[model samples]
Target: MDLNWVPAADRPDLVAEPVRPALRDDVRVAEIDPALADTAEFCERYGMPLDTSANCVIVAAKRGGEVRYAACMVLATSRADVNGVVRRHLEARKASFAPMDQATSLTGMEYGGITPLGLPAGWPILVDAAVIERSEVVVGSGLRRSKLLLPGKALAELPGAEVLPLAQ
Candidate 1:
């Protein structure tokens, strides 16, 4: 009931300039205990429904000695279709979650706080269609000690984002 969301503008590095303005006016940011940053913990501690929380995971795949990176967003109720839909879409033979080192370093976000917003350009974002239907969803704030909440449709409109049935 109390998400404690403040203005997202206060967190500059955590939110990219381009991505921030594109988000809706109702989007909010809030400080959270780093320990509760993960989906289950955050939902349990904050009294938010698990179904309304989304996980944005970075994935890696290789093809012909070249590596491709992608971010897949799925609701906590479901897992990302990594090896199936994601692999096929990336056109890679095998796809798996990116290492913590790579994911955090590339996105400039904490391991447990990576969000779909502020991802490196050229990286494709595959959002589960179901996740976009929620009126409000809680995601990471680029820091384990904070979280961001916004309309699910706002994420659907991000640059290079594809709203697909990407969860199983």
Candidate 2:
């Protein structure tokens, strides 16, 4: 499938140190109208199903006085078990969504465009089991104007990924 992926390396936001090497060979990216960055709108505009787009959410909590971040990828149709499955997985006493500024700064990606492909090491990349069952899925491209389409199984194999029943 010609996903119309331009070189992900071309984007300055994703091409820097510690970021470029993290994107895998199998991942591909494409530009979209910025207005379509949201999953539902993007799906409708692109003729993709809502279920085939995965949302990467950042969840955080403090443990031992250090804040830990986990990237949770769940299908647009479902929601991440943030406080339940995720908090337990991270061993967090309490967990909630990471603030927008923190998420953007830490991942070096736009607010609506973080993906699991190039997240920082040591941060858990939690994948919902259902997402991997698909042959390909759409995810963010590190910018509001683009999206990534890659094999769902490939996402499950990222360095820090843990595939589980992460969606509720």
- Candidate maximizing TM-score: 1
- lDDT tens digits, residue span 1-168, model 1: 356677687665445343464445677888777888899999999888899899999999888888999999999999998999999999998899999999988887788999888788889999999989999888887788778888999888888899999989
Q: Clashes per prediction? A: 0, 0
Every candidate's lDDT: 0.85, 0.83
Worst 10 residues of 2 by lDDT: 10-19
The regions of model 1 sitting more than 4 angstroms off are 10-24
| Residue 47 of model 2, lDDT score | 84
How far out, in Å, is residue 101 in model 2?
0.3
lDDT of 2 by residue, 107-159 (tens): 98888888886788788999999999999888887778778778899888889
